[model samples]
Target: MNIKSLLLGSAAALAVVSGAQAADAIVAAEPEPVEYVRVCDAYGTGYFYIPGTETCLKIEGYIRFQVDVGPDESGPSSWDAFTRGQVQFTAKSDTEYGPLTGVIVLQANADNATFQDTILDSAYLDIAGFRAGLFYSWWDDGLSGETDDIGSPVTLHNSIRYQYESGDFYAGISVDELEDSPFYNGETPNNVGVAVGLGGKAGAFSYQVTAGYDTDNEAGAVRAMGTVAVGPGTFGLAAVWASDPGAYYNAAEWAIAAEYAIQATDKLKITPGAQWYGNYGVVNGATDADFGSDDAWKVGLTVDYQITDNFYAKATVNYLDGDDIDDVTTGYFRLQRAF
Candidate 1:
């Protein structure tokens, strides 16, 4: 009888201890999985998908240092040396209609003794070949060398543009917003510019012709350029005609420019170019007496060298002569690193 009673007491104590241990035990829940960044090659290199989104983003930019020297020592004809850095972000994704893309570019610069404010250089959206926002217009396209001034008075503008491409044939049109002049009178109305271009390539030859009109000034400009591959070089010809002094092509009433860029070596190119202008000093208008109707001409040599995969150096020297102004020498040396 005593042995039976002792066994019952030990069993009750063990059961109580087991219940206590069960109550004190802690349970841990599993953790959520992590999402990783993925490479997106559908667009191009250096693009990756956002951790939780379908969109892909690419970041790229370039840093450039340039020294510009001109004849005069003071005023507008003085020299300018500057360092500039730019960063660009491009986001892209596929949609029902087509590929949707957005781009933003920021730039900072130090010119001469002044540190300029950082600015938004370009921001635009493109979808199905339609583009909008602030960007370089189609008129900014020029020859391969820097010896030619072949763009609007203000090359950058808030614009809406559409482009279409088929094989080697392409075309584009733009409506650009023009900024008010510093001499704006309260009665001066707002202004806008319109431009259109058509281009094509055939074997060793390619050409583009573009026209622009300034609504405020009631003036228009037309430009045509062509390039052909010849032996180890490319020969380019460009001509521009303007009805009067306007925003798009005021460098001259009419101008003719030409250049032959020779690939002297795998890493070096040499280009000698020339330009002749009719009524070059008529930049402002018939009202601005400072710029006369004198003719001008320029000849220049440009050199480009690739130092490394992402580094390049360029230099150009030009001599200018006009009926009203004395002969002058001007050029610039630039180094750029791009990624």
Candidate 2:
């Protein structure tokens, strides 16, 4: 063969080999597919299914800015401002027993440039009709307005409860660890309490009855409340009776409250409420001399305005009077946004 022919043949072979290598490199392997989060409408809004899991998760909460005027039993502050934020997490799944759910809430408050400690507002689990956890006491049933204090103290404690529900009828019973409860009076031998509640609604009328028994003091309190729709508003009436006064009802032997919530407009609500306390000033089985007054009453008005879908503003003014105590007035304004 001639020298030129030999060189041409060698170059052609080299080109063929390089072309094959380039073709192999251009052919890439297929990639794995990706999974995305899916929305879960089974429970409610703002819920989504966890990737690759049947469990559904939801997160919700609110932020509140409040301004208060007047003096409380705590101290004499002409005005005070505070901001509070809360977040809640919920997880739900279906099980053989029924729908199982868990919830956790965290809260923080800041007042006058001082930040308070964070709080676990609520943590609980529910399956079927059984629940257990740290939560508010069952005695918390009352009207919407803050002035309607049905003599039930607001506090949280560890508890286990079983509840039954059918349509608008429901009943529940709970046992609480009352050692750290706000109702615990000094040196109580017993540190447990039991509570039961029954509630139902028929048409535009609804009623609820709740009772709590303190094992240590061998005393209890009973509260009954009813509401009915009348004209452009709803009227509510509630009464409470306690055997140990402040230990259970956070009031005297007996107390009564009435409120009327008027839907003045689509975005505005006005509620006027009144409460009367009889045989006032008994706390933890002991009667204080300052509570010498046998009767005390309070009248208050609340106005709530919905600024937007998730924003609201509320204002409340209250007047308090008693047989021996000086007349006092208090009020607060609050703005809140929720998700």
Candidate 3:
């Protein structure tokens, strides 16, 4: 070959080798992928997080099935027949923002239109001691009175809330609206209220008081509840008082509940509880107050077993008495697996 052609070929080979080396260097300098941690707020109010991170995401929920053996056996009997509750799908996210910590939640239920319709249960943004968004009403725990029998009280309402901590005492205040359904016309505009709660714990005893108001109609209520651990068991009591000037028969009502939990074994727990309420105007009108006054009572027993950190089984039986109303009985058996 000619010298000029050989020189040109040599230069081309060198340029190709340089181009390949440059591509290799670029690949080596690529940014590493970020690793993230997950967080979840499941099984009610507790929040859990994964290790080694500031940002976390968690998913949790459960399913429940109920069997009813009412006063008449021939009246109704079958599987997928009685009343099947919905499955809850809840997610939580936690992160740090400058000097503040932020938490957000999204929860909903599946299959049951009676309770929820893939709703935004809690769409709140919380940071430090303040929160604002859509969430559960502050005064609702006692006013709902649904008892988790057929529905959940996780009503997503608009609200703004604040929490403060001092020493061992913690307090919170919230202003929000909630569903006053099955009473006063379910179509009524959201009822507004202000809720206040205070809680403190020392040793084995913990107590909390939750109260609220809706001044427009002289409608307001309050709740006081506490729990104590005694020996191998725990006991709790709650009382609620509410008044609705808009009602006719009885304008006021109150409810009291007591519960006891005993750990029969390391994996087994038994909880027995009872609740009594009087002057439940709405429910009174719905059921037959035909046999007695507007008084109602319920007795319940729940057994739970934790097979593992991710698996559990729960069975519950509730006997509700509205006096003269068929003595509604609800029993639930549920098995849940967590991820």
Candidate 4:
């Protein structure tokens, strides 16, 4: 044990193996600061940002296929085919009291076999502009064509609404629950509907007016519409009035409509429509108090095409004539895919 005690135990075993290799090269955690998924553009495009929660979300959907040919509804020039699917989910945030929203939609119909279960095409809640539960009301906001049949076959339900907007003006009101309308055949009771709306837009025009009331057959309805921006597209007009047979328009005791939407390029579109009724009184499925004398008329043509970025295709054709109704010619053909 001479040479200075073996060089002082080999310099203390190389300083204890260099302090265990600098404590095994240090780093035990750092991968946990990731949060990724963010793009919420404040609720405009596809949305996102739900990961740790500033709420924002969006999901969209569509799937459809259709074919139909008519003659007073599949009894004279019959043809049919159908498929459908839909989905939606939206959420937003921005507290204080203005931007907060929620929505849900689900739909399915593949006729007779599978996919017949899901159905709740809307579930709502909106804020600031107030809203609640189910949806679709305002007499279904008609007038874009497919040969106008002004509305009131029960456009969804359960509601409570309110709205207001400035600048371009706006207004709304609702309080529905039409005891399962479709013109309620269980004879009266289970009613209470009311809706009102007013709209606006200027420069290139736009307008809307609506009203409805069906306090258990105390009857009521009204509608109005307008549009302009002539030349390459847009031109419209609409009117409706009712006072009987309850629940919104009841298929006319007064009606009028017209349209012209032509884009024809950048992926096609075309529309041409007309409608006139005046004491029409629809009766397709029983339960009625009718409206007035009887008279009807329609004419239509519609087309749309855009085969990318969300996909689409549509077709329409119509011709109807009436007075206790019967003359017919109808149409449909469609395809869709969206996201």
Candidate 5:
């Protein structure tokens, strides 16, 4: 009787323990899906985040320098260095009211007294299509194409901009601040501009028109640009005009540019372009007059080779047509990384 009872009790206990172990194994074997961060590379300084998560912050930027050689052949030759190292933080959080977005961008090229030392490039807020704070002017919305540069040979400016888009049509309004001076009085003048753009499979075309008044002068202008893709090659055109030139009286400025590129191989790309600048007036003997000869133009050619997806070498030459016109040749080697 003792042996049978002991054996039965031991078997019952073993069965209970086996059932508990099986339950634990089943729980441990179940797999759960992993969450991943979302990365967007379509826009400037792409963003990163966890999918379906709240606004995640992202930072991206680049550094570049170039060596310049004067075109006078015997003229002074030196290395010109420039850099744009920026960390742009952005967030887009969903709220019961709606979606809100914020951005802060800071950049520099060492320190100099030429202009403001710490140039706050961009800081702004956006809700849907409405935007407010310092931003790019509508007249230069096309500037995005040259993201590598603040605004081409020039740096960026602060302005209040509003943007909206529907289908293939887009438009925006930008109100900017103009420096104060005798012509602009001691008060900063407000300048406003509007932009309209159309994009489709054939490529994209955008035009911007602006008008505003300062203390003692009025300014207005129009600019148009387009891009076309031909097989593996691409071409682009840009035209600009202004009525009240700041340097010349009643001076009108106009420019035209075109570029073509081809992939000679998997690692090499060659782009050649020419630009023309025409002016209407000049400041001669303290008086503003139509000098006609004051008009200027520029032409450039570039060749770039990709050592790897993140590294590249480029060479460029530019010819300027003006009173002190000079040819400029530049070479650059750069490395980049992305996350």
Candidate 6:
């Protein structure tokens, strides 16, 4: 071949090679695929599947502002304002036995001037109707309004429980550690309590009976409650009897409460309730002289208004009267937003 032809051939080959190299450099690699969060409807609404796991997670919370006007420790009566925020995390997974769930709730409160301490309100696990960990006492379950107090003091406890539910019938039993319970008086004994509850619904009527025994005091209390639908509202009745006063159950010997929740509108509810206490204020086997009252009664009205899907307001006014004590009136207003 001629030298000029050879040189032209070499240049053409070099240009071809360089062009191929440039084309290869300009070509980009494919991007990695993204994993998006998937909605989990297996449990309920507002739940999403946890990434890279079969578990489902749900986060919910509420912010509340409250104004209270009532008796205080140092003052006869005072008005106080407080704000509270709460967050709850829930995780659930299906298992061979049943659905396993874990919940954690954190709460913080602040007054108008000072910030209160944060608290872990609840931490618990449930599997196959079996539950354990720190939770509210089952005895505190009652009607929707605050007026349906059957004298059972509401508190939290570390407990283990098993519940069986079928259709409209349910039963549960629990063993609680009551060492740090507020119901204890001076010296506590066994510091343990047992609780059992049974309930069923038939047609428009539902009834529940619960009993709690304090091993330390060798005393127990029994509570029976029932509700029936009437027209556009519901009527509820509850009765409680305790062997010992203020011993993990009723604060008095016996108490009865009645409440009627009236649906004023689609977004408004009004509940009027009344409670009667026999041998009121008797605690730790104290006589009437200690409390200066043998009987007491309370009447209250609660109003709830739902402003939106996740916003609501509540107001409650209560009047308490005793045989030998001054009549007192208390009330509170609360605004809340939930998510």
Best by lDDT: 1
| lDDT per residue as tens, model 2, 22-109 | 7846557788788789999989888999988999999999999999988762366588888999999999999999989999999999
Better of 1 and 2 by lDDT: 1
Q: Compared with the true structure, what per-residue lDDT tens digits does model 3 show for residues 1-339?
A: 699999999999999999888784534566877655443444234444555544334344444443433445334542222322233333334436422333344434443345444444456666777878876653444311223221113335577889887877889988766545223422344566577888889888887787666533345566677788977888877776665422111222677888778888999888888887675434433332211346778888888889898678777777887744557776656666654
How do all models score by TM-score? 0.88, 0.90, 0.66, 0.34, 0.65, 0.88
Summed backbone clashes in each candidate are 0, 0, 3, 0, 2, 0
Runs off by more than 4 Å, candidate 4: 1-16, 19-24, 30-49, 54-65, 71-85, 102-126, 130-137, 141-148, 152-209, 212-326, 329-339
TM-score between candidate 4 and the true structure: 0.34
Residue pairs in collision within model 5: 37-50, 38-49
* Runs in model 1 lying further than 4 Å from the true structure: 1-20, 24-32, 72-79, 112-114, 180-189, 283-292
Model 2 residue 130 distance off true place after TM-score fit, in angstroms: 0.2
RMSD of 6: 3.4
Give the Cα lDDT of each candidate: 0.85, 0.84, 0.58, 0.82, 0.52, 0.84
Between candidates 2 and 6, which one is better according to TM-score? 2
Prediction 6 TM-score vs. true: 0.88
lDDT of 6 by residue, 244-285 (tens): 754466556788999999998999999999998887775444
For model 5, how big is the CA root-mean-square deviation? 8.4
Question: How large is the C-alpha RMSD of every model relative to the true structure?
Answer: 3.5, 2.9, 7.2, 19.3, 8.4, 3.4
Better of 1 and 5 by lDDT: 1
The worst-scoring run of ten residues by lDDT in candidate 2 lies at 284-293
Alpha carbon lDDT of residue 312, candidate 1? 99
- Sorted by TM-score (best first), the order is 2, 6, 1, 3, 5, 4
